[model samples]
Target: MELFEGRPADCSGRQEREVRVYDLLDRLGIAYQRTDHVPAGTMEDCDRIDAVLEVTICKNLFLCNRQKTAFYLLMMPGNKAFRTKDLAAQLGVARLSFGTPEDMLRLLDVTPGSVSVMGLMNDRDNQVQLVIDRDVLKGERIGCHPCLNTSSLRFATSDLLEKVLPAMGHSPILVNL
Candidate 1:
């Protein structure tokens, strides 16, 4: 895959969700690099893309409380081992589980295998809390799926935290893990 600056000139055949991500970034005046590839669901599939982007693509998890009333979007180092018990303690919440595909779609406008911070744009209700790893914020740049597993995007970490998240009405709670 090759990286191109900003939105694709020809977005004609792209999924609407993907297109919306690009549109939001452009509208926010945030520059990004993009590459198209086969849908990536595993780290092995992402290694090549990660190499090209020169940043570890954060692993995004869609999680919810036992009642499913509170939802969270977590961005963490792809290599970091995740332990629900650990995260639950940090967030002061009861047991958390992977959100269902149905809630993922309803709130984020994204299906399984394609969760990212970009999806927060669709959560106008601010129902989903953004939880990001402190390590992720330390990176100068971050790579992530553009609400579609078939494509990936790289953007300045500052733009995401300072501009994008605020615009999306998401104030991330930084976690060390």
Candidate 2:
């Protein structure tokens, strides 16, 4: 894989959602680095992408309560072990489960493998609450997909916390797990 300064010069075959991410970042004046690769479906694939980007890509989880009334996007380190009970306790929710692909698409406009904090831009209605792990905030830079698994992006964590998330109108709920 190769790293590019910003959005691909030729977006011919790229997904519209992917381009929109670039558009938003550009409008926000958030400088980022991007790398295009095949859809990342496994840890090995992500590790390779991480090596190229020089940052560990976050493991973004789309979760919902049993009734599906509350939706959340949890961002954490890719290598961290996730326990639903741990997060549920932190949120005071009885249970938390992975959201369905349909809900993921309807709410965040991203599929299972493509879930990322960037997808929160599509949640204009504030349907999904952003949940971030404390450890994720310790990093100087954040790595994530651009609403699609075929590419990944690296940018300042401060830019995400100070600029991007605020511009998207979503306030993140920081948690320990």
Give all TM-scores, in the order shown: 0.98, 0.99
* lDDT, each prediction: 0.93, 0.96
What would the per-residue lDDT of candidate 1 be over residues 52-71, giving only the tens digit for each residue? 88989999999999999999
lDDT of 1: 0.93
Please write out the lDDT profile of model 2 over residues 32-141, one tens digit for every residue: 99998998999999999999999999999999999999999999998899999999999999999999999999999999899999999999999999999999999899
- Model 2 scores a TM of 0.99
| Model 2 regions more than 4 Å off | none
After the best TM-score superposition of candidate 1, give how far the Cα of residue 37 lies from its true spot, in angstroms: 0.4
Q: What lDDT would candidate 2 get against the real structure? A: 0.96
